[model samples]
Target: MPDEQGHPELEEIELGKVLAALADPARRRVIKQLLEDEAGAERHCTSFGLQLSKATRSHHFRVLREAGLIRQVDRGNSRMAQLRYGEIELRFPGLLELIRREKEEQASSET
Candidate 1:
């Protein structure tokens, strides 16, 4: 079960859901960016610079959050996002490193 913030606990993270969430190229890009950013940095939704509809991007963020890949909170008028790196790493070793290594070419698709 997820917490009040809608984030799943480390022990509650399911691999199938995580993989499904990561399957989308756009979502993967989100993860990749989060991975590449400074540790513990919480980025705003607009900071990703995704040339996508606000609704579409919000969907992506929701997917990542529900899948336990990231955490999000309302910051002022916008939402702030951060990779659940340590939690994910504790549950699945080296998973994020693989995302980081994924070729940047695939992230070009804005959808």
Candidate 2:
């Protein structure tokens, strides 16, 4: 698979990198948003509404893309992101579901 702007190839996606990417609360939020989107829908970076500077936001996106958790494509003047759910599931079955469930449980406990 062609790496987009130096993003990791599917075969090169390491568990450590994925776990590290998800370790950040901000990145997890991004993943949660992508998971909530309808299948095959792409989310624009600005649509995330993350309270972060442009450089920081770009860094998070880069981490996600590099971890192979998301695919980004340049559309006109904007960059769109889509979760690579299928690819990740193939490589790490049930991983996303587990993470989502854990996050939900944590949220409920804090409420």
Where in model 1 is the C-alpha error above 4 Å? 109-111
Residue 15 of model 2 has an lDDT of 99
Over the stretch 1-111, how does candidate 2's per-residue lDDT look in tens digits? Answer: 546485677789999999999887778878887888887789999788788999999999999998999989899999999999988999999998866766554533442
Q: Write the per-residue lDDT of candidate 1 for residues 17-78, one digit (tens) a residue.
A: 99999888888888998888899889988787787999999889999999999999878887
Global lDDT of each model?
0.89, 0.84
lDDT at 70, model 2: 90
- Residue 76 in candidate 2 has what lDDT? 100
